[model samples]
Target: MLPPIYTWLKASNAVKAIIGNTPRAYRPGDAPQDVTQPYVTWALVAGVPDNQLSSTPPSDRYTVQVDCWHTTDKGVEDLAKAVRNAIEPNAHLTAIPVNNRDPETKLYRIALQFDVLQTR
Candidate 1:
């Protein structure tokens, strides 16, 4: 069975820090109920090839993806930044909106791709 959503979020220390210790609110409002609350339906981390590292063919870059519901567009930008910081602190991360349903469900799903050079 899939792990509980809260467990998944808490599994990462970086994620925990980004979202403080507090139960998130589920209601549609101006402010998020708590720091830990995610309007997110799903989130994950992945790795990609590092083509720039010609000397190191084994090197790979890290990436993160987040699917969430947003009440406003303003929060979408910040949410992406928060996600990047949570997953890739050292690497430069960029978020792109793969699917956006702003007025309908207010859901703003984004896929953030970045490069985290692997080291031995």
Candidate 2:
């Protein structure tokens, strides 16, 4: 299932506001030992709606999903932390889950979900 369009838009806007204005850099000489390469790139994927079911009635809740891609594990973790820090500070943001994908290759992708409460 997917979240509603409005939820997606809100989440996308939040992510863009957090990441798009942040300053970042890549120093070739400051590369970590675990990372063989001297470069890293990070980007936040557009928010998507994730459908979720409720245990009680026929009601459902929507989740906003965002993905972050990095060239190294450290970079991915850093970005994930940044995302959590960015969203958790908002009073409207209820819950957030950050997941690390398996198959550790040259590229790492972190999936972030920010759940919004349906009721007050």
* Candidate with best TM-score: 1
Error of 2 at 53 (Å): 21
lDDT string, candidate 2, 1-120, tens digits: 333322332354443443343222122243345643222232222333334475433333445554555666777776656655554543134333445554656466665566543431
How does each model score on TM-score? 0.43, 0.40
**Model 1 C-alpha lDDT per residue in residues 1-120, reported as the tens digit of each score:** 111334444455544444444423122243444433345534336655555645654556555444544455545555555555554544555656465655644455455555455542
lDDT of 1: 0.47
TM-score of candidate 2 relative to the true fold: 0.40
RMSD of each: 8.6, 10.8
Q: What lDDT would each prediction earn against the true structure?
A: 0.47, 0.44
